[model samples]
Target: MKCIVGLGNPGKRYKDTRHNVGFMAIDELIRRNHWELDKSKFNGNYTVEHIGNEKVILLQPQTFMNLSGESIKPLMNYYNIDVEDVLVIYDDLDLPAGKIRLRQKGGHGGHNGIRSTIDHLGTKEFKRIRIGVGRPVKPIPVVDYVLGNFSEEEQADIAISIKNSADACEMWLKKPFLEVMNEYNS
Candidate 1:
Protein backbone atom coordinates (compact mmCIF):
# COMPACT_ATOMS: atom_id res chain seq x y z
CA MET A 1 0.00 0.00 0.00
CA LYS A 2 1.13 3.56 -0.70
CA CYS A 3 0.51 6.05 2.06
CA ILE A 4 0.28 9.83 1.81
CA VAL A 5 0.33 11.57 5.17
CA GLY A 6 -0.37 15.26 5.71
CA LEU A 7 0.87 16.92 8.92
CA GLY A 8 -1.11 19.63 10.72
CA ASN A 9 -2.75 20.52 13.97
CA PRO A 10 -6.35 19.35 14.36
CA GLY A 11 -9.03 21.95 15.04
CA LYS A 12 -11.07 24.57 13.27
CA ARG A 13 -8.88 27.32 14.74
CA TYR A 14 -5.89 26.07 12.78
CA LYS A 15 -7.86 25.52 9.61
CA ASP A 16 -6.38 28.35 7.53
CA THR A 17 -3.08 28.89 9.28
CA ARG A 18 0.21 28.63 7.41
CA HIS A 19 1.09 25.53 9.39
CA ASN A 20 -1.94 23.71 8.05
CA VAL A 21 -0.89 23.86 4.42
CA GLY A 22 -0.20 20.14 4.58
CA PHE A 23 -3.80 19.53 5.41
CA MET A 24 -4.79 21.79 2.56
CA ALA A 25 -2.83 19.66 0.11
CA ILE A 26 -4.51 16.54 1.36
CA ASP A 27 -7.85 18.28 0.98
CA GLU A 28 -7.04 19.00 -2.60
CA LEU A 29 -6.06 15.40 -3.19
CA ILE A 30 -9.34 14.20 -1.74
CA ARG A 31 -11.28 16.58 -3.93
CA ARG A 32 -9.39 15.53 -7.04
CA ASN A 33 -9.84 11.84 -6.35
CA HIS A 34 -13.51 12.21 -5.34
CA TRP A 35 -12.93 10.42 -2.04
CA GLU A 36 -13.86 11.15 1.52
CA LEU A 37 -11.90 10.45 4.70
CA ASP A 38 -14.82 8.73 6.36
CA LYS A 39 -12.84 6.37 8.60
CA SER A 40 -11.24 7.38 11.85
CA LYS A 41 -8.48 5.06 13.00
CA PHE A 42 -4.90 5.05 14.20
CA ASN A 43 -5.39 8.44 15.81
CA GLY A 44 -6.18 9.89 12.40
CA ASN A 45 -8.71 10.32 9.60
CA TYR A 46 -8.13 8.17 6.55
CA THR A 47 -9.60 6.80 3.36
CA VAL A 48 -8.32 4.36 0.78
CA GLU A 49 -8.52 4.46 -3.00
CA HIS A 50 -7.63 1.61 -5.26
CA ILE A 51 -5.86 2.91 -8.33
CA GLY A 52 -5.19 0.12 -10.78
CA ASN A 53 -3.75 -2.65 -8.57
CA GLU A 54 -2.23 -0.31 -5.98
CA LYS A 55 -4.03 0.79 -2.86
CA VAL A 56 -3.48 4.44 -1.93
CA ILE A 57 -4.19 5.55 1.58
CA LEU A 58 -4.51 9.25 2.38
CA LEU A 59 -4.11 10.27 6.00
CA GLN A 60 -4.49 13.32 8.23
CA PRO A 61 -3.21 12.83 11.73
CA GLN A 62 -5.65 14.01 14.38
CA THR A 63 -2.99 13.88 17.07
CA PHE A 64 -1.91 17.39 16.02
CA MET A 65 1.37 18.59 14.60
CA ASN A 66 3.86 17.92 17.37
CA LEU A 67 2.72 14.36 17.95
CA SER A 68 1.90 13.45 14.36
CA GLY A 69 3.94 10.30 14.57
CA GLU A 70 1.64 8.96 17.26
CA SER A 71 -0.98 8.60 14.57
CA ILE A 72 1.20 7.76 11.55
CA LYS A 73 3.16 4.94 13.14
CA PRO A 74 0.11 2.99 14.23
CA LEU A 75 -1.69 3.51 10.95
CA MET A 76 1.32 2.39 8.96
CA ASN A 77 1.72 -0.65 11.16
CA TYR A 78 -1.93 -1.57 10.85
CA TYR A 79 -1.82 -1.20 7.08
CA ASN A 80 1.47 -3.12 6.84
CA ILE A 81 3.01 -0.32 4.80
CA ASP A 82 6.74 0.15 4.52
CA VAL A 83 8.62 3.37 5.20
CA GLU A 84 9.63 3.64 1.56
CA ASP A 85 6.04 3.76 0.40
CA VAL A 86 5.19 6.69 2.64
CA LEU A 87 5.22 10.30 1.53
CA VAL A 88 4.79 13.07 4.07
CA ILE A 89 3.51 16.48 2.99
CA TYR A 90 4.00 19.50 5.23
CA ASP A 91 4.84 23.22 5.31
CA ASP A 92 8.38 24.58 5.10
CA LEU A 93 9.28 28.08 6.22
CA ASP A 94 12.68 27.93 4.52
CA LEU A 95 11.39 28.46 1.00
CA PRO A 96 9.39 31.25 -0.61
CA ALA A 97 5.67 31.19 -0.06
CA GLY A 98 3.93 28.52 -2.14
CA LYS A 99 7.12 26.93 -3.37
CA ILE A 100 7.20 23.14 -3.18
CA ARG A 101 10.10 20.73 -2.98
CA LEU A 102 10.29 16.95 -2.98
CA ARG A 103 12.97 14.92 -1.25
CA GLN A 104 13.57 11.19 -1.04
CA LYS A 105 14.99 11.35 2.49
CA GLY A 106 16.26 13.90 4.94
CA GLY A 107 16.33 15.11 8.52
CA HIS A 108 13.35 17.01 9.87
CA GLY A 109 15.07 20.40 9.43
CA GLY A 110 13.68 21.55 12.78
CA HIS A 111 10.03 20.88 11.95
CA ASN A 112 8.44 19.46 15.09
CA GLY A 113 5.97 17.38 13.12
CA ILE A 114 8.71 15.91 10.94
CA ARG A 115 10.85 15.38 14.02
CA SER A 116 8.12 13.38 15.68
CA THR A 117 7.60 11.37 12.52
CA ILE A 118 11.30 10.58 12.17
CA ASP A 119 11.51 9.61 15.81
CA HIS A 120 8.55 7.27 15.63
CA LEU A 121 9.49 5.75 12.29
CA GLY A 122 13.16 5.42 13.35
CA THR A 123 14.27 6.45 9.90
CA LYS A 124 14.30 9.42 7.50
CA GLU A 125 14.16 7.25 4.42
CA PHE A 126 10.54 8.10 3.65
CA LYS A 127 9.61 10.57 0.96
CA ARG A 128 8.52 14.16 1.65
CA ILE A 129 6.91 17.11 -0.09
CA ARG A 130 7.67 20.42 1.61
CA ILE A 131 5.29 23.24 0.78
CA GLY A 132 6.77 26.65 1.48
CA VAL A 133 4.93 28.92 3.88
CA GLY A 134 7.73 31.51 3.85
CA ARG A 135 9.75 32.92 6.72
CA PRO A 136 8.46 35.67 8.98
CA VAL A 137 8.78 39.17 7.64
CA LYS A 138 10.58 40.57 10.66
CA PRO A 139 11.62 39.38 14.11
CA ILE A 140 8.25 37.94 15.00
CA PRO A 141 8.21 34.71 16.95
CA VAL A 142 8.28 31.66 14.68
CA VAL A 143 5.32 30.12 16.40
CA ASP A 144 3.17 33.18 15.89
CA TYR A 145 4.30 33.43 12.30
CA VAL A 146 3.50 29.84 11.43
CA LEU A 147 0.15 29.85 13.20
CA GLY A 148 -0.85 33.08 11.48
CA ASN A 149 -3.10 33.17 8.48
CA PHE A 150 -1.74 33.88 5.03
CA SER A 151 -1.80 37.35 3.54
CA GLU A 152 -4.37 38.13 0.88
CA GLU A 153 -1.73 38.00 -1.83
CA GLU A 154 -0.21 34.85 -0.42
CA GLN A 155 -3.55 33.12 -0.50
CA ALA A 156 -3.47 32.87 -4.27
CA ASP A 157 0.03 31.42 -4.36
CA ILE A 158 -0.68 28.97 -1.60
CA ALA A 159 -3.84 27.79 -3.29
CA ILE A 160 -1.93 27.09 -6.47
CA SER A 161 0.74 25.22 -4.56
CA ILE A 162 -1.85 23.08 -2.82
CA LYS A 163 -3.38 22.13 -6.17
CA ASN A 164 0.03 21.31 -7.63
CA SER A 165 0.94 19.25 -4.60
CA ALA A 166 -2.21 17.21 -5.07
CA ASP A 167 -1.32 16.72 -8.71
CA ALA A 168 2.12 15.52 -7.67
CA CYS A 169 0.61 12.94 -5.33
CA GLU A 170 -1.39 11.49 -8.22
CA MET A 171 1.79 11.33 -10.29
CA TRP A 172 3.47 9.22 -7.59
CA LEU A 173 1.20 6.28 -8.33
CA LYS A 174 2.16 6.33 -11.99
CA LYS A 175 5.92 7.00 -12.05
CA PRO A 176 9.10 6.50 -10.11
CA PHE A 177 9.43 8.89 -7.19
CA LEU A 178 12.70 10.27 -8.54
CA GLU A 179 11.02 11.17 -11.80
CA VAL A 180 8.10 12.78 -10.02
CA MET A 181 10.52 14.78 -7.88
CA ASN A 182 12.45 15.94 -10.89
CA GLU A 183 9.28 16.96 -12.68
CA TYR A 184 7.71 18.79 -9.75
CA ASN A 185 10.67 20.02 -7.71
CA SER A 186 11.73 22.36 -10.49
Candidate 2:
Protein backbone atom coordinates (compact mmCIF):
# COMPACT_ATOMS: atom_id res chain seq x y z
CA MET A 1 0.00 0.00 0.00
CA LYS A 2 1.10 3.59 -0.64
CA CYS A 3 -0.07 7.05 0.30
CA ILE A 4 -0.05 9.77 -2.34
CA VAL A 5 -0.44 13.35 -1.10
CA GLY A 6 -1.26 16.33 -3.29
CA LEU A 7 -0.30 19.43 -1.35
CA GLY A 8 -2.63 22.42 -1.48
CA ASN A 9 -5.02 24.54 0.52
CA PRO A 10 -8.70 23.67 0.62
CA GLY A 11 -11.12 26.29 -0.69
CA LYS A 12 -12.62 27.81 -3.79
CA ARG A 13 -10.41 30.93 -3.57
CA TYR A 14 -7.26 28.85 -3.92
CA LYS A 15 -8.57 26.70 -6.72
CA ASP A 16 -6.47 28.33 -9.45
CA THR A 17 -3.45 29.31 -7.42
CA ARG A 18 -0.02 28.07 -8.46
CA HIS A 19 0.31 26.43 -5.06
CA ASN A 20 -2.90 24.58 -5.75
CA VAL A 21 -1.43 22.87 -8.80
CA GLY A 22 -1.11 19.78 -6.70
CA PHE A 23 -4.84 19.69 -6.22
CA MET A 24 -5.38 20.21 -9.94
CA ALA A 25 -3.18 17.26 -10.81
CA ILE A 26 -5.02 15.08 -8.38
CA ASP A 27 -8.24 16.19 -9.98
CA GLU A 28 -6.90 14.93 -13.29
CA LEU A 29 -5.98 11.59 -11.79
CA ILE A 30 -9.42 11.19 -10.29
CA ARG A 31 -11.11 11.99 -13.56
CA ARG A 32 -8.82 9.82 -15.65
CA ASN A 33 -9.07 6.90 -13.28
CA HIS A 34 -12.79 7.43 -12.68
CA TRP A 35 -12.28 7.43 -8.93
CA GLU A 36 -14.28 9.45 -6.44
CA LEU A 37 -12.57 11.57 -3.83
CA ASP A 38 -15.72 12.01 -1.82
CA LYS A 39 -14.71 10.17 1.30
CA SER A 40 -13.10 11.86 4.26
CA LYS A 41 -10.12 9.85 5.45
CA PHE A 42 -6.58 10.42 6.58
CA ASN A 43 -7.38 14.05 7.35
CA GLY A 44 -8.44 14.75 3.78
CA ASN A 45 -10.37 13.55 0.79
CA TYR A 46 -9.12 10.18 -0.42
CA THR A 47 -10.00 6.99 -2.18
CA VAL A 48 -8.32 3.62 -2.32
CA GLU A 49 -7.80 2.06 -5.70
CA HIS A 50 -6.08 -0.95 -7.03
CA ILE A 51 -3.01 -0.34 -9.16
CA GLY A 52 -2.22 -3.94 -9.94
CA ASN A 53 -1.87 -5.72 -6.58
CA GLU A 54 -0.98 -2.56 -4.77
CA LYS A 55 -3.58 -0.68 -2.74
CA VAL A 56 -2.95 3.00 -3.26
CA ILE A 57 -4.54 5.83 -1.31
CA LEU A 58 -4.92 9.08 -3.20
CA LEU A 59 -4.98 11.85 -0.60
CA GLN A 60 -5.43 15.61 -0.69
CA PRO A 61 -4.56 16.66 2.81
CA GLN A 62 -7.03 19.20 4.17
CA THR A 63 -4.58 20.36 6.79
CA PHE A 64 -3.50 22.93 4.23
CA MET A 65 -0.02 23.53 2.74
CA ASN A 66 2.53 24.22 5.48
CA LEU A 67 0.86 21.88 7.97
CA SER A 68 0.44 19.03 5.50
CA GLY A 69 2.79 16.80 7.40
CA GLU A 70 0.41 16.78 10.34
CA SER A 71 -2.13 15.06 8.14
CA ILE A 72 0.46 12.76 6.56
CA LYS A 73 2.09 11.50 9.73
CA PRO A 74 -1.21 10.42 11.22
CA LEU A 75 -2.25 8.56 8.10
CA MET A 76 1.14 6.89 7.82
CA ASN A 77 0.93 5.76 11.40
CA TYR A 78 -2.61 4.48 11.03
CA TYR A 79 -1.76 2.46 7.96
CA ASN A 80 1.75 1.49 9.02
CA ILE A 81 3.16 2.87 5.79
CA ASP A 82 6.83 3.30 5.18
CA VAL A 83 8.17 6.66 4.16
CA GLU A 84 9.32 5.26 0.81
CA ASP A 85 5.79 4.26 -0.09
CA VAL A 86 4.73 7.90 0.09
CA LEU A 87 4.50 10.15 -2.95
CA VAL A 88 4.13 13.92 -2.57
CA ILE A 89 3.11 15.99 -5.58
CA TYR A 90 3.42 19.77 -5.29
CA ASP A 91 4.29 22.94 -7.22
CA ASP A 92 7.95 23.89 -7.69
CA LEU A 93 9.01 27.52 -8.02
CA ASP A 94 12.55 26.93 -9.28
CA LEU A 95 11.53 24.94 -12.33
CA PRO A 96 10.03 26.62 -15.38
CA ALA A 97 6.43 26.46 -16.44
CA GLY A 98 5.32 23.03 -17.73
CA LYS A 99 8.62 21.55 -16.56
CA ILE A 100 8.48 18.50 -14.20
CA ARG A 101 10.83 16.73 -11.86
CA LEU A 102 10.61 13.48 -9.88
CA ARG A 103 13.04 12.80 -7.08
CA GLN A 104 13.30 10.05 -4.51
CA LYS A 105 14.21 12.46 -1.72
CA GLY A 106 16.26 15.52 -0.78
CA GLY A 107 16.04 18.88 0.99
CA HIS A 108 12.94 21.05 0.74
CA GLY A 109 14.42 23.79 -1.52
CA GLY A 110 12.60 26.49 0.50
CA HIS A 111 9.15 25.00 0.05
CA ASN A 112 7.31 25.19 3.34
CA GLY A 113 5.16 22.17 2.65
CA ILE A 114 8.13 20.08 1.64
CA ARG A 115 10.13 21.33 4.62
CA SER A 116 7.29 20.39 6.95
CA THR A 117 7.03 16.95 5.42
CA ILE A 118 10.75 16.40 5.85
CA ASP A 119 10.67 17.63 9.44
CA HIS A 120 7.85 15.31 10.47
CA LEU A 121 9.05 12.33 8.47
CA GLY A 122 12.43 12.64 10.22
CA THR A 123 14.17 11.91 6.91
CA LYS A 124 14.50 13.24 3.39
CA GLU A 125 13.85 9.84 1.85
CA PHE A 126 10.50 9.79 0.16
CA LYS A 127 9.15 10.11 -3.36
CA ARG A 128 8.21 13.52 -4.70
CA ILE A 129 6.65 14.66 -7.95
CA ARG A 130 7.54 18.33 -8.43
CA ILE A 131 5.44 20.17 -10.97
CA GLY A 132 6.60 23.55 -12.26
CA VAL A 133 4.43 26.66 -12.12
CA GLY A 134 7.38 28.96 -12.96
CA ARG A 135 8.41 32.11 -11.15
CA PRO A 136 7.08 35.63 -11.50
CA VAL A 137 8.84 38.16 -13.77
CA LYS A 138 10.00 40.33 -10.87
CA PRO A 139 10.98 39.22 -7.40
CA ILE A 140 7.99 39.07 -5.11
CA PRO A 141 7.12 37.70 -1.72
CA VAL A 142 7.35 33.88 -1.83
CA VAL A 143 4.04 33.60 -0.02
CA ASP A 144 2.26 35.85 -2.48
CA TYR A 145 3.78 34.11 -5.47
CA VAL A 146 2.71 30.71 -4.28
CA LEU A 147 -0.68 31.70 -2.98
CA GLY A 148 -1.66 33.90 -5.89
CA ASN A 149 -3.80 32.62 -8.74
CA PHE A 150 -2.29 32.02 -12.15
CA SER A 151 -2.43 34.46 -15.02
CA GLU A 152 -4.03 33.56 -18.35
CA GLU A 153 -0.73 32.52 -19.94
CA GLU A 154 0.34 30.71 -16.81
CA GLN A 155 -2.93 28.77 -16.69
CA ALA A 156 -2.39 27.41 -20.20
CA ASP A 157 1.01 25.95 -19.32
CA ILE A 158 -0.22 24.77 -15.94
CA ALA A 159 -3.01 22.78 -17.54
CA ILE A 160 -0.47 20.79 -19.51
CA SER A 161 1.73 20.34 -16.47
CA ILE A 162 -1.21 19.04 -14.44
CA LYS A 163 -2.08 16.40 -17.01
CA ASN A 164 1.52 15.28 -17.22
CA SER A 165 1.69 15.12 -13.44
CA ALA A 166 -1.38 12.92 -13.31
CA ASP A 167 0.16 10.66 -15.95
CA ALA A 168 3.40 10.56 -14.02
CA CYS A 169 1.60 9.52 -10.86
CA GLU A 170 -0.12 6.73 -12.75
CA MET A 171 3.22 5.68 -14.21
CA TRP A 172 4.84 5.73 -10.80
CA LEU A 173 2.11 3.50 -9.47
CA LYS A 174 2.44 1.13 -12.40
CA LYS A 175 6.25 1.06 -12.75
CA PRO A 176 9.53 1.90 -11.08
CA PHE A 177 10.34 5.45 -9.94
CA LEU A 178 13.42 5.57 -12.16
CA GLU A 179 11.30 4.95 -15.23
CA VAL A 180 9.27 8.10 -14.51
CA MET A 181 12.32 10.16 -13.47
CA ASN A 182 14.28 9.25 -16.61
CA GLU A 183 11.40 9.82 -18.99
CA TYR A 184 9.80 12.89 -17.42
CA ASN A 185 12.45 14.62 -15.36
CA SER A 186 14.60 15.85 -18.23
Candidate 3:
Protein backbone atom coordinates (compact mmCIF):
# COMPACT_ATOMS: atom_id res chain seq x y z
CA MET A 1 0.00 0.00 0.00
CA LYS A 2 1.05 3.58 -0.66
CA CYS A 3 0.23 6.65 1.37
CA ILE A 4 -0.23 10.19 0.12
CA VAL A 5 -0.43 12.89 2.78
CA GLY A 6 -1.38 16.52 2.26
CA LEU A 7 -0.35 18.94 5.01
CA GLY A 8 -2.49 21.93 6.01
CA ASN A 9 -4.40 23.48 8.84
CA PRO A 10 -7.96 22.29 9.30
CA GLY A 11 -11.20 24.34 9.50
CA LYS A 12 -13.09 26.63 7.19
CA ARG A 13 -11.08 29.72 8.06
CA TYR A 14 -8.03 28.30 6.27
CA LYS A 15 -9.89 26.73 3.37
CA ASP A 16 -8.50 28.83 0.55
CA THR A 17 -5.36 30.26 2.08
CA ARG A 18 -1.94 29.92 0.46
CA HIS A 19 -0.92 27.42 3.15
CA ASN A 20 -3.76 25.16 2.13
CA VAL A 21 -2.57 24.43 -1.38
CA GLY A 22 -1.64 20.93 -0.28
CA PHE A 23 -5.22 20.35 0.75
CA MET A 24 -6.34 21.82 -2.54
CA ALA A 25 -4.22 19.29 -4.43
CA ILE A 26 -5.65 16.43 -2.41
CA ASP A 27 -9.14 17.72 -3.11
CA GLU A 28 -8.39 17.71 -6.82
CA LEU A 29 -7.18 14.10 -6.62
CA ILE A 30 -10.29 13.04 -4.72
CA ARG A 31 -12.46 14.77 -7.28
CA ARG A 32 -10.73 13.13 -10.22
CA ASN A 33 -11.07 9.69 -8.67
CA HIS A 34 -14.65 10.21 -7.50
CA TRP A 35 -13.57 9.18 -4.01
CA GLU A 36 -14.46 10.72 -0.70
CA LEU A 37 -12.42 11.00 2.49
CA ASP A 38 -15.18 9.25 4.41
CA LYS A 39 -12.98 7.74 7.11
CA SER A 40 -11.42 9.50 10.04
CA LYS A 41 -8.49 8.14 12.04
CA PHE A 42 -5.17 9.23 13.48
CA ASN A 43 -6.48 12.77 13.47
CA GLY A 44 -6.80 12.68 9.73
CA ASN A 45 -9.47 12.41 7.06
CA TYR A 46 -8.60 9.68 4.60
CA THR A 47 -9.81 7.30 1.93
CA VAL A 48 -8.50 3.95 0.80
CA GLU A 49 -8.86 3.07 -2.85
CA HIS A 50 -7.07 1.68 -5.87
CA ILE A 51 -5.35 3.69 -8.52
CA GLY A 52 -4.82 1.10 -11.19
CA ASN A 53 -3.71 -2.01 -9.29
CA GLU A 54 -2.03 -0.15 -6.44
CA LYS A 55 -3.89 0.48 -3.22
CA VAL A 56 -3.47 4.01 -1.97
CA ILE A 57 -4.49 5.94 1.09
CA LEU A 58 -5.14 9.64 0.63
CA LEU A 59 -4.73 11.55 3.89
CA GLN A 60 -5.26 15.11 5.06
CA PRO A 61 -3.96 15.51 8.57
CA GLN A 62 -6.28 17.45 10.85
CA THR A 63 -3.63 18.16 13.45
CA PHE A 64 -2.93 21.45 11.67
CA MET A 65 0.24 22.23 9.77
CA ASN A 66 2.86 22.42 12.51
CA LEU A 67 1.86 19.16 14.17
CA SER A 68 1.12 17.16 11.04
CA GLY A 69 3.54 14.37 11.95
CA GLU A 70 1.42 13.61 14.99
CA SER A 71 -1.21 12.36 12.59
CA ILE A 72 0.87 10.81 9.79
CA LYS A 73 3.10 8.47 11.79
CA PRO A 74 0.22 6.63 13.41
CA LEU A 75 -1.76 6.15 10.22
CA MET A 76 1.34 4.83 8.52
CA ASN A 77 2.06 2.46 11.39
CA TYR A 78 -1.47 1.12 11.38
CA TYR A 79 -1.34 0.58 7.65
CA ASN A 80 2.18 -0.94 7.82
CA ILE A 81 3.34 1.33 5.06
CA ASP A 82 7.06 1.86 4.67
CA VAL A 83 8.58 5.32 4.64
CA GLU A 84 9.51 4.71 1.04
CA ASP A 85 5.90 4.18 0.10
CA VAL A 86 4.82 7.58 1.36
CA LEU A 87 4.48 10.84 -0.50
CA VAL A 88 3.81 14.10 1.32
CA ILE A 89 2.37 17.17 -0.37
CA TYR A 90 2.77 20.66 1.01
CA ASP A 91 3.31 24.30 0.03
CA ASP A 92 6.69 25.84 -0.84
CA LEU A 93 7.48 29.50 -0.29
CA ASP A 94 10.54 29.60 -2.54
CA LEU A 95 9.05 28.59 -5.88
CA PRO A 96 6.74 30.80 -7.88
CA ALA A 97 3.01 30.27 -7.79
CA GLY A 98 1.72 27.63 -10.26
CA LYS A 99 4.93 25.65 -9.97
CA ILE A 100 5.29 22.22 -8.37
CA ARG A 101 8.47 20.37 -7.46
CA LEU A 102 8.99 16.72 -6.63
CA ARG A 103 11.87 15.41 -4.55
CA GLN A 104 12.69 11.98 -3.23
CA LYS A 105 14.36 13.26 -0.10
CA GLY A 106 15.34 16.53 1.54
CA GLY A 107 15.26 18.63 4.70
CA HIS A 108 12.14 20.61 5.57
CA GLY A 109 13.72 23.88 4.39
CA GLY A 110 12.17 25.64 7.41
CA HIS A 111 8.64 24.32 6.88
CA ASN A 112 7.18 23.42 10.24
CA GLY A 113 4.90 20.78 8.86
CA ILE A 114 7.76 19.02 7.13
CA ARG A 115 9.92 19.46 10.20
CA SER A 116 7.38 17.72 12.36
CA THR A 117 7.00 15.03 9.76
CA ILE A 118 10.73 14.40 9.62
CA ASP A 119 10.84 14.34 13.40
CA HIS A 120 8.21 11.64 13.76
CA LEU A 121 9.06 9.67 10.65
CA GLY A 122 12.73 9.70 11.70
CA THR A 123 14.01 10.49 8.23
CA LYS A 124 13.99 12.98 5.38
CA GLU A 125 14.11 10.24 2.74
CA PHE A 126 10.45 10.06 1.88
CA LYS A 127 8.98 11.50 -1.29
CA ARG A 128 7.46 14.97 -1.53
CA ILE A 129 5.40 17.12 -3.85
CA ARG A 130 5.73 20.80 -3.07
CA ILE A 131 3.19 23.22 -4.47
CA GLY A 132 4.63 26.68 -4.71
CA VAL A 133 2.69 29.52 -3.07
CA GLY A 134 5.64 31.93 -3.32
CA ARG A 135 7.04 34.25 -0.69
CA PRO A 136 5.14 37.44 0.10
CA VAL A 137 5.98 40.20 -2.34
CA LYS A 138 5.22 42.86 0.25
CA PRO A 139 6.42 43.29 3.82
CA ILE A 140 3.69 41.16 5.43
CA PRO A 141 4.71 38.70 8.12
CA VAL A 142 5.25 35.15 6.88
CA VAL A 143 2.42 33.72 8.94
CA ASP A 144 -0.05 36.32 7.77
CA TYR A 145 1.07 35.96 4.20
CA VAL A 146 0.66 32.17 4.26
CA LEU A 147 -2.74 32.45 5.88
CA GLY A 148 -3.98 34.99 3.35
CA ASN A 149 -6.08 33.98 0.41
CA PHE A 150 -4.66 34.15 -3.08
CA SER A 151 -5.20 37.21 -5.18
CA GLU A 152 -7.62 36.89 -8.13
CA GLU A 153 -4.67 36.94 -10.51
CA GLU A 154 -3.03 34.01 -8.71
CA GLN A 155 -6.17 31.89 -8.56
CA ALA A 156 -5.92 30.83 -12.19
CA ASP A 157 -2.30 29.75 -11.75
CA ILE A 158 -3.07 27.94 -8.51
CA ALA A 159 -5.87 26.06 -10.20
CA ILE A 160 -3.54 24.81 -12.89
CA SER A 161 -0.89 23.80 -10.37
CA ILE A 162 -3.47 21.86 -8.37
CA LYS A 163 -4.49 19.90 -11.44
CA ASN A 164 -0.88 19.20 -12.33
CA SER A 165 -0.20 18.01 -8.82
CA ALA A 166 -3.08 15.59 -9.00
CA ASP A 167 -1.93 14.32 -12.37
CA ALA A 168 1.61 13.72 -11.09
CA CYS A 169 0.22 11.72 -8.16
CA GLU A 170 -1.83 9.49 -10.43
CA MET A 171 1.15 8.91 -12.65
CA TRP A 172 3.27 7.96 -9.64
CA LEU A 173 0.90 5.07 -8.98
CA LYS A 174 1.86 3.57 -12.32
CA LYS A 175 5.47 4.65 -12.76
CA PRO A 176 8.60 5.12 -10.71
CA PHE A 177 8.64 8.28 -8.64
CA LEU A 178 11.89 9.40 -10.25
CA GLU A 179 10.26 9.13 -13.66
CA VAL A 180 7.30 11.13 -12.44
CA MET A 181 9.65 13.78 -11.09
CA ASN A 182 11.62 13.93 -14.30
CA GLU A 183 8.49 14.37 -16.35
CA TYR A 184 6.77 16.87 -14.07
CA ASN A 185 9.74 18.84 -12.81
CA SER A 186 10.92 19.63 -16.32
lDDT for every model? 0.93, 0.87, 0.95
Runs in model 2 with CA error above 4 Å? none
TM-score for all predictions?
A: 0.98, 0.95, 0.99
Instruction: Please give the range of 10 consecutive residues that has the lowest summed lDDT in model 1.
Output: 46-55
Residue pairs with backbone atoms closer than 3 Å in model 2 (clashes): none
Task: Please give, for residues 1-186, the per-residue lDDT of candidate 2 as tens digits.
Answer: 887889999989888888988888888988988898977865788888887787888888898899888888888898898998999999999988888889999899999888989988899999998999888887898789889988887777888888888888888887888898898877
Superposition-based RMSD of candidate 1 using all C-alpha atoms, in angstroms? 0.8
Off by over 4 Å in 1: none
lDDT tens digits, residue span 1-186, model 3: 999998899999999999999899899999988999999999999999998899999999999999999999999999999999999999999989999999999999999999999999999999999999998989999999999999998999899999999999999999999999999999
RMSD to truth, every model? 0.8, 1.2, 0.5
Error of 2 at 116 (Å): 1.1
Residue 175, model 2: lDDT of 87
- lDDT of candidate 1? 0.93
Clashing pairs in 1: none
